[model samples]
Target: MKSNNTLTFSRRNFIRTSALASGGMLIGFNFFTACKDKVAPPVDISQLNFNNFNAFIKIADNGIVTIFSPNPEIGQGVKTSMPMIIAEELDVAWKDVHVAQGILDTKNYQRQVAGGSQSIRFGWDALRQTGATAKQMLVNAAAAKWGVDASSCSASEGVITNANGDKLGYGDVVKEAAAMEVPENVKLKDPKDYKIIGQDIRNVDIDKIITGKPLFGLDYTAEGMQYASVLRPPAFGQKLVDFDDTAAKAVTGVSEVVRFGDKIAVIASNTWAAMKGKKALKVNWQVDSKLENTADHDKILMDLLDGNSFDTRREDGNVKKAFAEADQVIERTYESPFLPHNCMEPMNFYADVTADKVHLVGPIQTPAGTARRVAEMLERNVDDIHLEMTRMGGGFGRRLYGDFVMEAAEVSNLIKKPVKVVFSREDDMAAGIYRPAIKYRIKASIKDGKVTGYHLKEAAINSNMYGLIPNFFPAGAIANYKVDTANYNSNITTGAWRAPYTNFLAFAEQSFFDELAEALEMDPVQLRLDLLQNVKGTTDERIQYSGERMENTIKLAAKKANWGKKQDGVYQGFSAYYSHNTHVAEVAEVVIKDGFPVVKKVVVAVDCGIVVNPLGAKNQIEGGVIDGIGHAMYSDFGFNEGAPEHTNFNSYQLIRMNQTPIVETYFVENELSPTGLGEPALPPAGGAVANAIKAATGQRLYKQPFIKYIGMEEQELIG
Candidate 1:
């Protein structure tokens, strides 16, 4: 990929229009790029190391610029995007710079966890301001040396140039810049001056990633590092009744086959040896004879349709009155099965444990949480456990759980040596912590060809990935709404995957809207727009959403897609969801082939505030669309007689290159502060694809894994 300077200069015009700023001096100044004082004043930047030259910046005589961002890059591409925000404002050639992943430093970097689509927006102002402040200090140093007014000097491309264009390199002025007092206030660069942020830059680490350099935890290997493999019961809470490790102990390269509590592990010289030894070790599981099958989870969820739930998240008026007055009512039940994260790289962590301290390295999403947990488990201070985050093969939010890390710590402690615990596909899938199998009861009232009311009730195993957002509970996405939920304690362990509840939300809400639109005889997009025109909140009441913004995104996406204009045999479906402080709308075009929804194209429009890295933003939207489509259309988890039904990729399907659709991502020009990008885009795609399938077959399929709703092998044979 030719990542040259041409794209950098073109982005200046992007900021020129996006920032809507004026004046050449403001444009030339690095501090003026982000323009934060519109509805709110600039956040106080004093008395913090966030923008400190030594903390975020390290200048080299060779002109290599490093901007440290304290966030993990879980395939959303913020690793490259956030740094671009600073480099663009600094007016430096992007190629001359590199972005260093900021470690577990809370004071220097705010909220380092990169789950929501927030990486770029989170760093937008702070980093730009940091760069601008550094530039101001440098210019001041030059002005003092040249005996000219500070205002007489301007900054351009890592250099402070005087009015006559007399230039001084940033490296020459850095020592002086470091000594100056931090600026109380500095004018940010007008967007017209941006040389990096808006441009489509290639990924910063793609070269290392593609060249097979060690970028992910699975690829990490250290000298004196022993390997380990875990053997947990196939069922969620099943325990070991008995085990014989005679074969495992005799296997080549195997050191010890030991049981840590009920779970067993094989420690060896290599991952293969550990895996082979684990398979060789025989174990008997004490099955829960009375355990409820997943089908029972389905029944309990369906039983909640009678309206027994929390009624926790609500903000709208009487939905009963709205539905009562409506000309027609459309009701549907949506169901999604428990899904394994199946992150391309199975769960793995490398840890070196000694009596005094432990060092951990791997693809972990929540470094702070992991650090906290690891410290507690090790009975050491938090500072004693150093967490180094690796670029994840993929994190649909599965890595958020630190089980693999804990396993590594356990193995190291048991053997008193540094050990790496790597999960094979079988180990990863069989381990619980799946997206909970859940169900939703959605009812909508339509009058005069528009949606008038919505009553949504969802039930699932509580305490799943991302238990609940502070304000927007499950029922927060629509108005004239009555939202309720109930948690049925299951033996299964669950955690966040991609968009979390978004998986079911897309299916339930979007599918209901589709049915309602059909009953009202209105276009799905038009009906959604009309409803949102008056639809106040994501959760109703205090958890309201900006209807204007939602309407704008739908409209922009429709216009870009040329809705109802093109001749597409493939059906197109649309859905929008607001979570993690961002509004994302997606349109998925799907082809129903023998009950399978083949997603062909994805059109996405997002508003997460200022666009940081256009390339990263696009990559995230694309990846999310593909990831969600996979789960919605094919992914499933089953249980047979209290045992997990699937072990690896063979049983659990995923959306791959042959199945990935052509994704067209368009970022709505906004400067809203950052929100999560990692999982937000995915949740909405579920509904979009389901809606497209509805368009294709004049049928409302409420159950998930689109494969199930259409006709499973058992169902078709029975029918």
Candidate 2:
């Protein structure tokens, strides 16, 4: 039997095991077309001895060190921070290191994933060891050359120096180091000795980005790359019934129109022609049923929540008995609409497929997974598939699913040529796969100003598909606690968003806690603090979150926000949550301007252990907070007849720069290992803002995209 807490296969293990098998030293650095004037000659990478180190590090004869970041860089700074771990242990100067993106190779790199913010958390030890192993090899090489003990030589600044002060750069001894066997137990430098790990090093690609270098997926090109635009089904669950491609082929520069299971593609010499050709193609869709509108889905959710049957996720003491015996009970129903990721780059990918092999390059979060899926889809061996990752404008968990990547591969295979599939803004927005709309009912029983019992029932379209563990917070803290979930089947695609379930669950639970605090006649901060104290020394090993860590973050955020002090024209709300192995507490200050919630400031405290880069971590928190606020305030997706009603930004609202708040972040200083910071700061923003809106307007916003309940005209989900 499998244990609930059993660790699963991870990418870090793959890299570590492979590195150790090669004596803990990776060889070879893979380079793409870096110069425009001269095309580099193709060399058989498989024949190079340097291929052993392909995924991690490469040192050139000029002493320039290159580190390949295994995970995709979806604008969360993993490309920079992951290498910092290895570079720190290697005692290398950041300025001398060149960062390169790694290809998807499970045999070499392992789990090269960018979602769930697990890159750093999982790669920390393995990456440090990779660097330490290499550093030791360089030291051993130098010691052997000097005819001295390896222990007598020290490595620093990418060079090894002896007691006599004679120094050899890594480049000078790399060949010798490569000849030496890798040590199985190379000691890593202590955190105190780190020069690059904790520093706020600037992004390696900043210069190239500012200088207009072609780095994004859209900017990439091949010798004979043709642009292709696909016309997907109008609504979810709809299938392509028929299509006439004569009109599409008549369009200037239109090459051909190809049909797939779910969509019709138009390949053209240019992007505009492909788009226009796609538009010109006459197509029809057949729906299985009268397109289920948003109202129908909402009703389905409500019915599930009210049903007696449920998949019990977690249960402690008798919640029914505790609630029945409570002094007072406070309950609220919260609903959140479907949300689109709207990654700035839009969905685009390039694929070149032939009978022998396939090569794909694009902005994807899960390169290795995509490679495997594409290989399986195309009936090809995994080794025959090559995937290259580009810098993503934004992931927000949208790129984790490789449906778009598969589409590109399909189109390339159909056309028998290199093709780039680009989803126009409208196509991207209207295409399904959104954050699942969910409804949460949270009830709390308060007795003598203490929470006695708590119950949460979550109703969602295909619940828990993203591994959103139901008992996220306040689970082990409350004595009489229960979590139940109901799933409603639907045709629309649903997948992970930032923080997944916690993003919306935190809002409902934390906001309800505010109401519970009111019922108990206690401060909101104090109520959470008391709850944390209640679970401090519990013997429950199943409790995933630490009470002490949560308490520290909560206290720090309250202190930073001056929790109880009165302010002019501003009301404060406090919320804390733990997700992705990181603890975050946020305090929001808000005021009603023209009857709309105008957030003035947000004070965030994070405990992700030892922050790899303070500036990057802070920026991630600020971005997560703003993103959470934007989604909570103005973002919502409504489907009419199974299709997204809002096509683009004109109808679907996003947070504007003017609406952003002044965000200040602080991290708990500790010697513990680091966790991910990509998503933890996002969950509490909705709750904090909603609670603040209540303080400002005396009205509790139970529905998401709170703008609908404000002075703005409310829009219904039905057609």
Provide the RMSD of all predictions against the true structure, rounded to 1 decimal: 7.8, 5.7
Which tens-of-lDDT digit does each residue in 1-719 have in candidate 1?
11122122122211210111121011111221322211111122232222221124555545467665457888878778777777776767787786776555322222457565555654555566656665677788778878899999988788878988888887676655555655566677655456776778898899998899988998888889999999987675577899999999888999987778778989999988999999997889875545558877767777766644564555466788988898888776677788888777888999998876778899988776777787788788765776778888888778777888888887788888888999988888878577888777777776766566776666787644334342442244344666656677777777776676666776677777766767777888887777664445343456535676777888877778777764657787888877766778888787867666678888888876656667777777788788888777778887765667888777678766798899898877754555566666887888888777767766566677776666444233112
Please list the residue runs of candidate 1 whose C-alpha ends up more than 4 Å from where it truly belongs after superposition.
Answer: 1-55, 105-110, 287-290, 307-309, 324-326, 447-450, 463-479, 535-541, 566-570, 591-597, 671-675, 711-719
Residue pairs in collision within model 2: 11-111, 26-53, 27-53
Candidate 1 contains a number of clashing pairs equal to 27
Give the C-alpha lDDT of model 1. Answer: 0.69
Candidate 2 C-alpha error for residue 469, in Å: 2.6
Q: lDDT, candidate 2, residue 174? A: 73
Q: Which candidate number would show the highest lDDT if scored against the true structure?
A: 2
The alpha-carbon lDDT assigned to residue 416 of candidate 2 equals 96
Residue 285 error, candidate 2, Å = 2.6
State the displacement of the C-alpha of residue 14, model 2, in Å, after optimal TM-score superposition: 9.2
